[model samples]
Target: MKIALFATCIVDAMYPEVAQATVTILRRLGHEIVFPSGQTCCGQMHINSGKFAQAEPVIAAHARAFSDTDWDVAVAPAASCVASLGHQQPMVARRMGNDALAAEAADIAGQTYELSQLLTDVLGITDAAADLGSYFPHRVTYHPSCHGMRLLRLGDRQSDLLRSVEGIDYVDLPLADACCGFGGTFSVKNPEVSSAMLADKIRTVHSTGAEVCTGGDASCLLHMGGGLSRFQRTGSFEGTPDVTAVHVRQTSSTDVGDDNVDHLTAVVGADDDDHLTPGEKGTSPAEPSRIQSGFRVGQSAVHLARILASTKEDPLRVQSEGATVSGGSLR
Candidate 1:
């Protein structure tokens, strides 16, 4: 199988290892790999930010880059980006009123696949240990980015592969379905709310007591990792240091888990009666912290993501086997 790799912006810049790992796994399975240098981003950030005008060329660039390629399939490590190709590309093109571009976008999207989608759906790979040489020995957990879980509906393909990895200790992350407070520009625009959300997510990560956390989106990992790194750097940046920055886009929802999260109290307009910013309220300087710490929601995403990421790609009959260590202990 010949595959063209879509190195998303985040993976291309910060976590190229994931792309490389993806390439390694596919090549080990006897798939030929090619990379499209013209690839930059899936225009997800632009799309999500409601900047349809700015995203036109980005969309065109994506379609042009992949449409000209002659591979059996195009694969990306991030589900959100792959989902963006199918879901947002046409929307973006249509928003620009470019019927021709929209059609082109649709064709490009149809050819793309998230990493797990390619591995299981196309390659018939069910066991990472046996087929992909996935040998992570540390106890790790995975967080499914929102777009991948909701928009792409990739469902459990990645998690199944992780479980099948050789010598891996897969711990279930708590409150897995909850957002980690990194919604791209939402973070800076709504910093306090984002912080509170991240706090909840990081607590879940810590409760699992895993050495590290993993996920399909480098943007999410970077957000969570940045927070975690900040916490580690400050020995509790406000509260903790194990969480970081989050991804800033969306993906398809494929029954990966429960996607029902009511707005947090800290979120403006969460209730019918709009509320003021934490600072705007007459509450003391210290009161805002308590309000944020008290909020509890979105606890199911990680678990739901892990489960959804394991199998169920086709949505008709999806079944997968979870990976477990056989007499293999984490140090």
Candidate 2:
């Protein structure tokens, strides 16, 4: 099959490895891969921030970029970006009064697929280890991005592929469907709420005791990895007390101010371990034991494409120590 790769802005600029991995996997599957060089941001950020006017050209460029390129199908590693192709592009073009561009946008959206959707649905890849020679012998957990889960309705396609990886101890993340709080500009405009949501996610990830947190979207993983990195350094969330566990919950109908509206409450200094039995101190009994911190010193965020692209011959290195977070990049 001939495939055009839609390397999203984040993957193209910040994490080219992920794009390369998408190419690698396709090439490995005996498919031809082509890059549409004119591709830029899918205008998700603009559309998400209510800048529809700014998104018109972006959506037009994306439609033109892929339309000009000859391929049977287009695939992107980022589910959010792919979701935008179908969900927002046409609407944005129509709103701009460019019916021609809107038609083009709709056509392009139909041809685009998230990497896992292409792999599992189009290619019929049930076993990653067998079909793609995917091998990653490490403890890992997956976070399903919101766009992938809610918009794309890509249930189990990503995680199913991960579970098929050879020697991969795939652990089911608690509240796996929860958003990582990196909703593009949503995190920027609402930093406090984002941080609080991130804290809960990081704590859940810590409980999994996985060496790496993998996800389809680089943005969410980046958000999570940064939070985990900070926790690894300071051993606690910012302004959070040094407690065994901090439970953040929403108010229930029985006791709270308003019944309809929910409120976030942080119960600090709770003994999370007190309820566990003698042997279940760190382990969840159903899954692995909790690691000392959210993630180990060198634990890092990795894209799903990179993990799927991994093979026994040239395995992707998993860092074990001396990890650092700088300039909002997690390493």
- Could you say which candidate leads in lDDT? 2
Residue range 96-178, candidate 1, lDDT tens digits: 89999999889878988888887788878888766654555556677878887888876787777778866667987656778
Kindly provide the TM-score of model 1 when superposed on the true structure, using C-alpha atoms. Answer: 0.72
Poorest stretch of ten by lDDT in candidate 2:
283-292
Candidate 2: clashing residue pairs, number: 0
Cα RMSD for candidates in order = 12.1, 9.3
Off by over 4 Å in 1: 237-331
Task: Highest TM-score: give the candidate number.
Answer: 2
Per-residue error (Å), model 2, residue 74: 0.3
Q: Could you give candidate 2's per-residue lDDT for residues 1-331 as a string of tens digits?
A: 9999999999888888889999999999999999887989899999999999999999988877888888999999999999999999999888889999999999989989999999999999999999999999989989999999999999999999999999999998877877888899999999887887787777777766788889999889889888877876766676432233522334565866755532222222245555456876542112111342234555567888988998989787676544343433333
Evaluated against the true structure, the overall lDDT of model 2 is 0.81
Worst 10 residues of 1 by lDDT: 312-321
